[model samples]
Target: MAQDPRALLAKADKQASSARGGFSLFGGKQDKLEIAADLYTQAANAFRVQKLGREAGQTLEKAAAIQQEINEPDDAANSFVEAYKAYRKDDPSSAARVLEKAIQHYTLRGNFRRAATHQQNLAELLELEIGDIPKAVAAYEIAGDWFQSDNAEALANKVFLKVADLAALEGMYPKAIERYEGVARSSAGNNLMKWSMKDYFLKAGICHLASRDKIAFKKALDSYVELDPSFPSMREFQLLNDMLEADDGGDAEAFADKIFLYDQMSKLDKWKTTMLLRVKSSTTAPKPPLLGCIEEDDDDGLA
Candidate 1:
């Protein structure tokens, strides 16, 4: 005769309750913890056999938690990953939560590579599944920091770029600029990254212009010149300088036409094209008046 599924569940529950009682009596002794983990695993197996997926995942998570308390972090992480897999089919949010637990366990165990990998996974889940761009950015930044701490500069740079891109998409221009500048500064010291530094400087300058900070834009240009004195001879540098001068002269239309002509003659890359458009838009707007209200009224009553 086949055993009843409910009977198996009841037996598993009894074992779990007994294990809990042992834990209370023994105060997390190794034997008690081992017993609790075993009971939880058994309960999870019984739940799975009965097609109670949610219950099975929960029970497996409980087993994982017990492993954590017992200082078996590797076991805890593995069990949490298993629980995440179990929950993924029916409840993606729950699966993400379990994966977070797994990441925490991996981080606590000083397995930074695994932790960073899982953090990236969680970020992707938040972005794709939850549609939380801010939280996803934060997760990616944390992952990047961890990768940097592990001396994985390539991986760290890739993750940081994601953060910068998302920040820009979210309209946080200052943050995007800062991240771009940081990556640019880091890349400047590397011969392999020589070609990318100019692009980074260009991006940072473009962001400064987008933020409507002419002072910052000028400073960024100066910094670029410092980095590469030959920049002034470059067509990009000459174009931007001419645009600034045109804006100052209140002839933004002339600059826009000039850019259009230049673009027709030589197609610009996406970054340069977008940046020039931003510059044109900036110049179209009139500058704000420099002087505010006077403290004292004159004889003409001007204040």
Candidate 2:
């Protein structure tokens, strides 16, 4: 008479065992397996309602495994996602593990868009849950590539921007610049995103300056102008030019002045602010003034 999870799971286990025993007049083995899978799903939801997350997750995993054996990748992946949701609150690593299985299922189905989205989700879990920045960046990059290949440039750019942010934070300037440039070039062709191109180019320029490769930076600036002639007139481009001049002169004050003025017009985000600070630090000026000890009336000859 009990409707508890254990009782429901026991019923589902009986159904699954019957599925593998022999074909019956009611249904074939495959049909019985599907019924068992459906029962497992019901048990999983019951476990979830009871706040037994690990039990729910495991039950859903069993459903997913059965679905996978029946060549129902979509159902398998959906079950995996449900299991991941169930596990995330209690055991995030297990959530990530099951989510990876879902991604694999989606990839095997040639559903790259879904795969890319799950990849981004995995990246978020790695970043926010596990605190794995490098893996997060790598996951984001993979998502970006998948999105791009799927002709989902908008999604690709969004993911690539995350890649650039974390990559730059890790001092992977070249990778950041590449990602920013990729987004910038892609955005240039879209009217709605065109306005943000300057922002992307500015980020790429900042990464270049942070790398201290003046020749490459100069070349990139020229290339940007060629890529989008309007880029030369953009305030973001002008700010980068001024910052580059300040870097060349080794004048920290000049760099700070330019940044302050730009911030007045358009505030910089934390990432940009951090990168600019690194570029400003390349300057040799603004050395800390030595604390001078003033002899207060030492002329009294007290020694």
Candidate 3:
């Protein structure tokens, strides 16, 4: 007798169908995918036990494909995740592929938070593993909203810094300064804020200098000095100082001539003298730089 081979196949198919149905009981809408996944998982195990690895992988892949086609993205994502975990040690590319699938699944579901998390993971891979700066930047930006919402300001600031650095590398001074400003605004009163302000002032000063906006450059440089007196770039400070001293006969000359000569002028005296002189020289100047420094609201005008 032929031992009913047809009957055995029929029974296996029935069991697989029933397993698929069971998935719906656990969760609606995505039941089919879950059920299929479970059935495929069992089939994969049986194939493995039978020493048919290729067949096991194929069966699992079919389950994942079905879930994807049916729009059961979460289940499909989980399936790929499982497959990658099973085989990634032997093939690193498998992990990347699986993660991409998960990202797409989350994106399609409007799960931005999850998508952003995956994007950040992708950025790590692109930056450290693939050495792809543009790709990493794209991923980092994709996760920007998430970082902002999560109060991960430091990470957000770091991303902005990276953008600024990249912009500076590309010689886009305005864009770089914009990025630096973002970093400063995000830093607020934290230690990171102070450092970011220092960097921003320096970069902005350079941008102003490049544009030959002497007044703005001087202002930025002064802000930099105020923020970080011991800034690592002392040479830059000295260079700007020399430039100011070199002014032949204009306000710079007169200012330079009397610079910090006041009896009570401390090391901080230069900025004060410059401010007073600037105000005296231009009464209509909208507001003094000292306006920004004063945290208090008062009607006292430079007294």
Candidate 4:
């Protein structure tokens, strides 16, 4: 027979209360705390089975607190992560909060890989759950740096690309270009990533255009080819060159035609679609101001 969740919760609560209250003749405070933490974890799992995420999360937090009190750092961190998992669906705010606690624990212990993983997770939580773009970018950047520190170049580059994507969305074009260009330059040496070079460079070019800087945008193209000799041969280079001419004349149609051709060959992702649209919008010349009160001769009838 399944144990009643309410009964399990009550039993866990009583055990935790007794552990926190005082020492006992049967055992020391640490022993009592261990038992209480175990019971709390058990109850938390039962609550999870019942889909009581909030209750499970809170109960798991109690276990984590007791684990910390008993100087079980690893257990405490694990409990905190478990609590975050439980709270994610029902209470994402609490989930992010506790997940950060676990991240801090891993960071303090010099666990860069774990820190990087959870930091990336935290960044997604901030990005997707909270809709906080700036904080999410910051967290993602930290995770990328940590991954780099851990010698995980592939993971670091992936996270850095995400930072670039979000930064471009926020209209921070220079920041986005820097990240994209940086990754492109770094990835140039890797044979596996060579094909992706044009993409990164293309994104950086679009971001430069999105910033509406024609001169710098033109210069960036030459710089990209220099960074990787193969870049000029790619279709991306031709597309950028086409857009540059269109931008000079403020010809929206010309710019769009170039994008259309490029899209047919290599489909643009959401980020590219957004950036290209920005570039397309900026290609139109601003309307001349209305001329008011223009002097005119009275029918010019030799008067």
Candidate that would win on TM-score: 4
Task: Sort by lDDT, best first.
Answer: 2, 4, 1, 3
Which residue segments of model 2 deviate by more than 4 Å?
Answer: 1-3, 21-28, 287-303
Question: In candidate 1, which residue pairs get closer than 3 Å at backbone N, Cα or C atoms, i.e. clash?
Answer: none
lDDT of 4 by residue, 225-303 (tens): 8988877778999998998888888876666667767766876665666567666666455422210001121122331
In terms of lDDT, the poorest run of 10 residues in model 2 is 289-298
Best by lDDT: 2
TM-score of each candidate? 0.67, 0.87, 0.47, 0.91
lDDT of 3 at 111: 76
Model 1, clash count? 0
Clashes of 4: 0
Off by over 4 Å in 4: 285-303
In model 3, the runs with Cα more than 4 Å from the true position are 1-36, 39-63, 69-71, 80-98, 149-152, 166-175, 191-196, 199-303
Model 1 Cα shift for residue 240 (angstroms):
4.3
lDDT of 1 by residue, 1-303 (tens): 434535644655565566566435544556666776776777777766667767778878878877877788788788888777677656768978999988987887798998998898888878877888999999999999999999988788888878876776666778878888778777777888756766666666666766778888888888888877767777667666766677677675666655655565555554455555555556655422210011011123321
Q: Write the per-residue lDDT of candidate 3 for residues 1-303, one digit (tens) a residue.
A: 322323433444554466456444445535544565566766655655555544555556666876766776677787665564444434445555666787887777777666777667766666656666666666666676566666777766666666665555444556666666667655555763664464465455445444445776667665566556665465435534553443322343343333323222323222233333433243233443433332132233543
Candidate 2 lDDT over 40-77, as tens digits, reads: 99999899888989899999999998998888889999
Best-first order by TM-score: 4, 2, 1, 3
lDDT of 2: 0.86
Reference-based lDDT, each prediction: 0.72, 0.86, 0.55, 0.84
**What is the lDDT for 265 in model 4?**
83
